[model samples]
Target: MNSNRPGVLILSHCGFSFLEDLKEQLQRRQLRCFVLTSLPLAEHVPARLEQIQVWADRLYTADSHQLKLEDVNNALQTLHKSGEQVTCCISVWEGYRHLMAAANAALGTYDIDAQQALALRNKLNVRNQLADAGLSQARAHALTAPVLQTLQAQSARYFIKPIHGIASYAAFPLREDTTWKALETLRLASVEDTVYASAFNDGLQFMAEDYIAGQEFSFETLLIDGQAHVVAIHEKYEVTETADTVLEDSCTTPPASLDQAQIAAGLQWLEKVLTCMALRWGCYHIEARFTGQHWDLIEINPRVGGSLISHSVEAVTHGHSMLSLWLDLLLASQDDHAPRDALAQQLNAFQWQADGISAQSVATFFRVYFAQPGTLSSVALNELPLAPTVKHILLKAGDVIPAHAREVFLGQLLWAFDRSRQAEELERLAHLSATALDIRYEPGTP
Candidate 1:
């Protein structure tokens, strides 16, 4: 560890609570930490910053980054001019990576700059590069139909997804009709199409490409020395939050569900992507679907998987912590890790419990996050409200909350046991959580 430098900077948007576990973990290792809370409201700003600063060595407000470009630059310039050096600037939050990159560039710190960072966040740009560079991938098109005339020129089942999205946010199966609707509604033909749909379309930018339908699993990796070394193959169990109406009823994952061949194929596929992306000095959470014999590319996230996948990895492996390694790399002048294969040394069975939510009004959900459970006696308040069927609820009353679900993965109940017992255990637990929450969705959206 570089005792000369403090530690890394954890940049967050809206709320900084997400960095809590990482800060605590680092302090356990006897390291200093800094926190900057970005709040949406002005009046509440300094108080929140000070509250964290009491525990943290320093603080920063998000206006320090978002309001003005120089706000971020000046901070960096001031830090450097004051004779300070950063080990690595990190953002487990995907959206804030741009701010991290921007700050690092301003400080001339050791990190990936604003341009190279784009390859990770911008999908269309990545798609074009993959196609032109001949990397292993399922093809992608940003056009709607008459516009896809050029895409139809290339034959494949083609998957469609937004250029900027996270947590499998809005990715889904698409056909010719989807392409036509999107292009026609946006008048895609009238304008020259670009890699990012955000500029030209009112809705979201989507890519239509060959849908690689097969056994699907997640791949977690950290690149070192321009190589995409493979990590654990996560057994992903999820429900489509889009098509489903009964929000809390969806979501289920069994145990040890991936085949050896599927694992091998996913590893092979990411190698090509890492190389093409020239990814080095960071972590990536990639989703790939394997057909009968071929591995097709889904989307790649150059960050850790949310829902505490990193925590689960450490629980199972009992080895290197993903966040620690990520921070080490970000702070490293030398690019190195225990080696991808060695890093994920544990295969012990574990599953993430990212089930479902009530999908009600933000205000309604607010009760679940902030109000405390009233001892089943005092006044009255549904402590675990929000359609109680959601089990193993993490939010306690009086606990401050983040604005969006993306920052926190709300799981009903997660059962961890032997793989043999996991299925039955999860079933019983899921049933219990379902009954407890009893989430009821009335006919229409309120």
Candidate 2:
């Protein structure tokens, strides 16, 4: 990093080694980092901001949390007034992109303006961008009940999601009239004063889009200086009721076997969306569904995916880290990660084995399956000894989680394989993971 360049400001929440891993990467490139604190919610107190600063190698102490737009302005004003030069503000927080983007604007940290930030945070604005760009996507609209009723009557399947939710929270899949009515109740419940309300209410609107059928996969990459650089693509096994109380016992990411042609098509679809969005620099996540050879846009987040998704994939697939690549791009971009790569459509998202259960059933199922293999995979439980493939096995006896494959499916069992035997080996481990962690919707269900 050039000594004259301003310190990099990382907007972080959810304490973990992500920051530390990033710090190590930056150190290798000699870039200095500063952690600026922001509240994730009413309770998103920046507890370890100072600790982050120490790990970051530079320090900026703005200890208060931002809730309203005014709060964001105040924080930005403070940063802008401070003599230090600001380089960039990266939103690595799980569900707090709006807050992160707002603070970035207040300080004039990047070129994006307040209006543009609103456009990114609001679902309604994104809908217009797709329409204006003439991008191929499911029909989407910010709706009134009458309009929703009419569309629901025509469409075979539809998706209902909050304009500004994190973790795919409150995402509803409308397949039947019953499901559609359940969504109506859910929509009204958002207006309720109860805790069961939809997370996005204030400026957040709900989006109903024609449900695009096919396998679902995710792509996470950094958009440095506007271009979308591919980072890690995850073969999504499931998208279930974990976030949406609207349904239950439904969600999974299946195996993603691919041909070079389909993979290229997917990448092209992503490239087109980014070009039209007028996005300049940041982390972005795109979800698209494929039917036969055609692909329909599901959604695109102008930030990183939640649940440490990119990081976990990298951990299991290759020795290289996705977050590490993102930090490198943010500070000192690699010259050759350019678009004209010799490699044809990269094999990014591939599910090797049985789909994962939600995070809820991870603990107990892992114990029994590892103890006895037939329950999960055909292999005998006693055949193999524990090895490095097990990253963090959350399955333990007596944990309170049930086996129902709802929101928190079998706890995430992520593992990596050596290239020479990567494909076959990882599949076996995934099968073992599923076997060890059985599913039970009700308590003691599995």
Candidate 2 structure quality by residue, lDDT tens digits, 1-446? 22554555565443332566666656665666655444332322355654564566454433433234454455445555664455555555533456656655545544344455556656656766676676765667776667677776773676777766544545767544535455555555555412212235463356776666777766665665655556445555433333353221111222245455676676677777877877766666776667777766766776555444654545543443556545444434324444223111231232221122111111111111112111222222233443423333333443343221113323444444433454455456545544444432323234
TM-score (C-alpha, index-matched) for candidate 2: 0.66
For model 2, what is the alpha-carbon lDDT of residue 160? 71
**Cand. 2 Cα-lDDT:** 0.49
Candidate 1 — worst ten consecutive residues by lDDT sum? 358-367
- TM-score of each model, in listed order: 0.68, 0.66
**Top candidate by TM-score:** 1
True-vs-predicted CA distance for residue 344, candidate 1, Å: 10
Cα lDDT of model 1 by residue, 290-399, tens digit:
66676655667767765545554443334445676566455543334443334333211221211211111111010111112121111122343223322244443333
Candidate 2's displacement at residue 65, Å, is 6.5
| Candidate 1 residue 442 C-alpha distance from true site, Å | 11
Report the alpha-carbon TM-score of model 1 versus the true structure.
0.68
